[model samples]
Target: MHEDIHVGGGLVTAFVAYALAAFVILIILRFAFARLRFSRYVANAPLAEAGLYVCVLALLIAFI
Candidate 1:
């Protein structure tokens, strides 16, 4: 009988940690920009919001 080896846990953990950090940073930036009146400009620009969403998603996917 043989035991199978589990691999890639460290890489997965790092990806999860990175994703959490990125989420936190995004939340912080969202609030900060709102407080600074930047969100108003952002709201008026649908393209910007779409672009941001795409970029964040790509980053998350890449980390995974």
Candidate 2:
């Protein structure tokens, strides 16, 4: 539960880890969404994508 993690002789916020994990998940989601035509389900596709990132980040922080 540290606020920072050391990597390659430097300290970075723990949030960065969560953010990166979320980004990877988002990348996978992107492919799935492409196949599903996700844009058609949302009026603002970009906003929905951003919201998905936030949700994924929160879940990672809460569970991992």
Candidate 3:
């Protein structure tokens, strides 16, 4: 029996790609939230931001 595994640009490259993607997503979310005054309604803005970042990162990893 034989098995094949494919590695994408090795681990370090994958990490950097995901990190850059998350950063870009967070920045865009920050601007959109600020422009729409979405943070005013949240009792904990920092926590909300963190949650949003995680969610966005998860979505990106899952879809892309």
TM-score of each: 0.45, 0.90, 0.72
Candidate 3, after superposition: displacement of residue 50 in Å?
A: 0.5
C-alpha lDDT of candidate 2 relative to the true structure: 0.94
Kindly give the stretch of ten consecutive residues in candidate 2 with the minimal lDDT sum: 1-10
Error of 2 at 1 (Å): 3.0
Candidate 2 on 1-64: residue-level lDDT in tens? 5579999999999989889989999999999999999999999999999999999999999998
Candidate ordering by lDDT (highest first): 2, 3, 1
lDDT of candidate 3 over 37-63, digit per residue (tens): 987899999999989888887777777
Give the clashing pairs for model 3: none
**Can you give the lDDT of residue 45 in candidate 2?**
96
Every candidate's lDDT: 0.59, 0.94, 0.76
Q: What is the C-alpha RMSD of each candidate to the true structure, in Å?
A: 8.1, 1.2, 5.7
lDDT head-to-head 2 vs 3, winner: 2
Regions of model 3 farther than 4 Å from truth? 1-13
At residue 29, give the lDDT of candidate 1.
Answer: 63
Better of 1 and 2 by lDDT: 2
In the range 14-50, model 1's lDDT, one tens digit per residue, is: 5455556666766776677677877567656556645
Q: Ten consecutive residues with minimal summed lDDT in candidate 1? A: 1-10
Candidate 1, which segments miss by more than 4 Å at Cα? Answer: 1-11, 43-64
